[model samples]
Target chain A: MDRNIAGVTIQVNEEGYLTNFAQWNTAIGDALAAEADLALTPRHWEVLNYLQTEFKNDSPLSIRKIGKSGVVDIKEFYQLFPTAPLKTASKIAGIPKPASCI
Target chain B: MKRILILGAGTAGTMMANHLHKELSPNQWEIDIIDEQEEHYYQPGYLFLPFDIYEPEDIIKPIRDFIPHGVNLLIEKIDRIVPREQYVQMENGDRLRYDILIIATGTKIAPEETEGMQGEEWKKSVFDFYTFNGSLDLRNKLREWQGGRLVVHVTEMPIKCPVAPLEFAFLADSYFKNKHIRDKVEITYVTPLSGAFTKPKATTALQHLLDEKHIHVETDFAIERVDNENKMIVDYGGREIPFDLLVTVPTNKGDDLIARSGLGDDLNFVPTDKGTLQSKAWQNIFVLGDATNIAASKAVSVAHFEAEILTENIKRFIAGEPLNAEFDGHANCFVETGNGKALLIDFNYTHEPVEGTFPLPGVGPLRLLKESRLNHMGKLAFRWIYWNMLLKGTHIPFVSTHMQEAGKEFA
Candidate 1:
């Protein structure tokens, strides 16, 4: 899968699961981690895990609808994730290297 | 002595003319306003015209009557603004020189921008409320016509008063209901935004309201063209929404004079410092209201808030004092939601519409993000305030230029 957003390139599978994690070394992930300015929390991790599982199941979750499904309020979910949860989690998971992250 | 030239004697321009006329003395400064049309329209009253709440005669007044005696009122089309030469050329091959220029040239519907929109259906099956003529034409059509699929559409974002489209939809629901044809007519709202509003929180609340009213919503629909022959609006994604009566807020663009002058953006809006209202192209030139390429909604209330800040800055510029860079994207809107109730929304650049009380926070006569009868009354009362106090440059009591955080109890 070829994914490009705001001039960044990413190659992944149909489920957006990465076949090549080696394409993005730890240095880029560490750099992205520094730039995001996010404090890693269990709740944030739970969302990332949920999104990864959803993507693996060949279904992309609607961030807003998911929020309204009782996990969190839509506003709080946005506060947690300004960009899309899938895109942000993809960066953290190092599944497909975000062009911006790289 | 300074020669100040203002373009378009519409709501924003008229208010600014009244403001400068009151602020500056005749001996110290000379003011001139240029507009092609002689009639001044009460735009807000257009919403009520279709329902016979406001007479067409009541909404119009002579432009010259409102302009003060000392100011030069040139009822002519502007050819172009030659800012480098500090003058604006008129259609009659005459030039009016200026020491300072204020651009309050507001926006209006541009139907030609959309494909097939201005064709056979225009003003017959289709109408717009932005213009006085369109409203009157729609009124005549709605009077004798039976109810059908009434589609209230917004062509794109940054249209004047975002809530007005929703208000029209709500009012249509009530109008058909009153006429005993509520069951016959189906109301639908089509917006380009992801939800009902551009803001996230307000979108959820307004989406809920839309559901409660049984109004169907088609979101994220970028209108490619109006398929007039098929009686449907075709989106780029091939989504065809049928409508019997298409009331659309056509693409709103700045005055043609801006495009002719070659000083405006792709949409013909002048680029200005978002906070200062100062023109990016020239130091002496300033812009206000819908003419600027600002992120805020192009509404009269925003213009009113911006006028306060811009007036102060202009005074400073005249005095050789440092300009004050302080204009929050303050926009306040009253959303009429049928059944004698309305919702008030107060927001700026960063803040979205939150559930709270406005004007006095906890003791608000108006509630933000919630429907109330008092808000409806306030919406009705504004037309009186607009003509009497607002246009006269008198500060409205209790309504501040900036959004006050005092009274609001955050959700």
Candidate 2:
């Protein structure tokens, strides 16, 4: 479904994760972060950029991978995005949430 | 004569061996399967081992029993694979060349990867059911144990038989109730995932079971370390879950040989084409089962389905035909929900397990995603099927290699 964020319509899933990265922009990301009650910090942008790069390269994201990414440790990641950091971060970063394959 | 070298004589490798042996002429091609272990274990039995429902003899057999007559079963330790040179280096300084390589090395639990996991408590207070020794030891522990806070935890994702830990928790509930100590025992399930399971619909169904069973859940918990002194698992966010006894599925990784050969990802899992089962780095090398970093459940059933498609693909590769991208990650599993009831789940890459009737579809022999005694019987009967039909590459009657969507109710 399409959701209006930051005065722009963007494609998102039921869980509010972005279905298309092409429609993602800084305004939409800022609005998503604002909805999650997070203020965009330079550190948060670095992690977002890292996540976007991983998404572009078609690499799956995990807390362990992010911890080892040297861009952010898992503890800081949790502090930044708070509860369910990976999911929340993925939402704001405009990427699909990491899927745990069954 | 050209040769096909298969690594790891486990379920996937053995199936591939049997399939290729019948397809390729003995005079024209040679098949060799290698594994250091002498015993072939029915790994699913590990879930029942801790509950004392299955005996060690029921799950173990001679590895040689499964190998075909024409195929050479070499019990030798592998040093590394020289992919560029197309040969495997054995530990004894022996090298075996191959025209094509099939890697089925599979995954193993690495408890040492976590901090304080292998500490003073090790097998005494903390245990893992993913290994034969661990399951047996846990069985012994459960035999005489007094009830207390029991924590069943999963350290990371992509563990072999991902549902086994949850099954352990369910069985533990039944076991405690049978012992008349259900009220005394506090059972808690800890996982890194956001819910009781990975899929939404299945998670809802399983979450209902967990609620009905009164199993406490701790989700979105990324474990950082196990504090032996406190008898608790500390997450990266500093959330600590205390326990009297901890049963954990530790970090699972592909064989070290993959790392030694410098042919794996960060977790030592080989990157393979998800659909084709061909190694991304080398075309001649094909991978299946838990060895490849595919987005499929690392279950025997998945391997069974892959064996069918991979067999055809292997023949195609040999015949100078285009390889079939047919492996759809089909995995059929029986979730033992305890108390003589089980749930049958059939799914593939594009589809999530949903409510339906399986095999016969609308006619119904087994119901999918719903608890029933018939499914429980199917789960029990699977042991015989695993040993006889599954291992021998015999096609299981009525079951298709790909996911069937006909009888399924997809929302």
Candidate 3:
């Protein structure tokens, strides 16, 4: 599998598992899969859906509304998402990590 | 011979050390400073660090470099301050007697105070920018970040530089936008305080800025815990904020030494006279910076103004003269709104951030309420002013110790 974004190369294996989304090119979608340690189900796809919309629109997607987007349960949505994913997403987007992050 | 002991060589203690060293005669007075940390951080620089504007080396210098020659610098952990006996106990089993004590031990991040805040996700998914290490970790995270639901949460009140959380949100907006991944990152600002700021008037103004930047503000959220396994922040009100990334300003409290001394209020800050800054429990003890329980923003500007007033009072107390009923809680801060523009706000205990020009009333280089590029430059320039002048206890020419009303336009 391959994803389209400049300077970002996402390659997955036969099972659509991320094989190499290297340090500099890792996408939030790929990071999410890594964070779960390849245990991502379609239920985790709610996060990917939210991220897709957020990236497509190039703006901050609302947490509450995103929760109601029917991807995940409202209770579980708050449970799964942390500041790390958003930060990782930025990294996955191939944006340079801030100095404070280092 | 009178001895003055200043605790913690951070901004407030460093200023007091420099101030007292200049005022008191070495022949008559012995000055000493105590702190365990070796590095003196230009804290204001931390706000600019994550954005790649300031290098870590630029923000940090050896703590000893800032302490002048005349003063004795004791690099050791403090055990407790025996205010009644006018003596401070050290962790190394030594006691230092002081005629007068300046408690500037400052505050620290206590993530454990909130459940799950310091779990496996900390510095991974959840991060804090308050500490140097935290900021550095965040830098690494942001560098490799692709973007997701980024929730910037302020755990509770009494945190240092109340505006920092909002600044992080604003800076993040600019950071991602510049990287061409602004589309991929979703930034949300979460605060326990209502609106974007602590004060009502300023909150309104700051909320407008947040709205302008498209950073969603979740107000009145008292965070219960950071569920690391689940990766969400749950509030006491059952309000849950889900984020792909969580940047938190955890519960800020005074030094653990204060708890040992049994001198602080419920929040672990010393109970100080709002006007005098003198510890209510002890006449010889004074608290400055983030260690005091004052209704002021825990920013360096407030500490700078407080230093001016406290230094004067310290002199009077030494000379057996009447302490001045001054110090109007003056705090002036520059808020970065990104894209080479910032907003300057100056207010005291009574007033809010009003619309006006600063420094020079009619022809100020810095604008208030309204954003300007000049104000952004002023914010950038302050790191120099803080080290070379402010911490040295040298008086700034145009900037008065008290909040000036000449330039501000009141509605």
Candidate 4:
């Protein structure tokens, strides 16, 4: 089903992750972060941008990579996305889910 | 000639087929094994399914492939066993008589025993990964679930692969972090035990892991019912913990056929001599694995160890000699702590997990009661060893069924 974010119909899966990256916008990001009960922070966006950029570059994301990404260290990475960093960051960043996630 | 009939072609039964057939002369012993299911699942792999660590194709294999060629593999449901007469009545109406019976029929997940657990939310919100189909269903459900209150619970103890629930919680912690929804989902572990594990020393070590992962634990909570409508589980004390998704290990009990045969206790567990694995009620009947009321943990490794001791005693029983072998209830398991790391624990009926090196004294390998990458590799590599080495009843070099004291530290 599609969700309305800022009066725009955005594609999403049953889990509320954006199905199409192109359909993602700031309004959708706001809505996703709101659903996660997390307020958008500059540090959170740094990791989100790193995840999004890595997805665009066709590079795989891992805890080790994000920990060394300079934007957020391993401890801070967990702090930003305490549940799951790559999957949550990618979803909020309008990227596909990682393969390693079970 | 004597007939040896083994029930349930699971890990224990399969091992027995090879172990006994090699020892008992073909001219003197005719062995037969029966199981309803065509597929044999590596039960440990079930713990990884929901987390997407292992796939269905990776764990399941045909039972016929595992059963030794000399033994007759009967793929039929058992109707009932006439224990006194020493014969099992097959559902297809065959009365197979046995001179000696080995009941290796393993325990099963009894979800129906728990009230409201299988309500409207069953396979929807409430899930179990104990069974083959249940694991596959849970895999799909977990993939679609964004993030919410993820509760990993155990209805009671004596569940197969006792460490599996903790492994699930650890993998779930890693899975969510990789997903970047770690904060979005709240992971809690609920068990009837007072601590993270049964053993005291291991409990302290594992409890630290739980606390490290920020996974809240609800201890000693005897569940009354699952309030599916309200998305909460109600304990007998009227305590309720709400969950967006409930992954539970329901009450595990032995096969009902044991109960029907009047050879089992109230929970359908066959009471057996802990040392000999021989059935207490009948001289000719023996039991092992999760089906037996042994003091050991219900683990595949325990079954493998029991198979060794039982095989030795079975030979003695056949030769009109005394059964002298003993099983010390030795069990070892790799506790996954996520992040491509795991902890190894080795213990027996008397010993809890202790800090030390394993197998070789002062050898620089395989640390115990502590996390290491080598232990993680060992955990992953065990699946191969389980099928090829363990099932073949081939003795693992330097590894004994009994727990050793050489390299272990008491403190």
Candidate No. with top DockQ: 2
Q: Rate the local accuracy (lDDT) of all candidates.
A: 0.77, 0.90, 0.76, 0.82
Per-residue CA lDDT of candidate 2, range A1-100, in tens? 8888898898887678888899999999899999999999999999999999977755566787788888998889998999788888999999877665
When superposed on Cα atoms, how far off is each prediction in RMSD? Answer: 11.1, 1.7, 17.1, 20.4
Pick the winner on lDDT between candidates 2 and 4: 2
Q: Worst ten-residue run, lDDT, model 4 chain B?
A: B192-201
Model 1 regions lying over 4 Å from their true place: A1-102
DockQ value of candidate 2: 0.48
Name the lDDT value of residue B77 in candidate 1. 87
Interface root-mean-square deviation (Å) of every model: 15.8, 2.3, 15.5, 18.9
Q: Which model, 2 or 3, shows the larger DockQ?
A: 2
lDDT of 4 by residue, B1-411 (tens): 789999999999999998988888899889999999899899889888878889888899998888777899999999888878989999889999999999999999989877899999999999998998899999999888899999999886567877788889999999999988899999999976554564546665566787879999887566778998899998755679999999999988889998888887545788888899998899899999989976577888899899999998998898888986489879888878899999888888667778788767668389988988999999999999988888888888877889998888875
Deviation in Å, model 4, residue B183 alpha carbon: 1.2
- Order of all candidates by DockQ, from best down to worst? 2, 1, 3, 4
Q: Higher-lDDT candidate among 2 and 3?
A: 2
**lDDT for each residue of candidate 3 in A32-85, tens digit (9 for 90 to 100):** 446545444555555655655544332223333344466664456545544333
- TM per candidate comes to 0.80, 0.96, 0.79, 0.79
DockQ of each: 0.04, 0.48, 0.01, 0.01
Q: How close is chain B to the truth by TM-score, in each candidate?
A: 0.97, 0.99, 0.97, 0.98
Count of clashes, each model: 1, 0, 46, 19
Q: Which stretches of candidate 2 lie over 4 Å from their true place?
A: A7-11, A20-26, A53-60, A99-102
- The candidate scoring highest on TM-score is 2
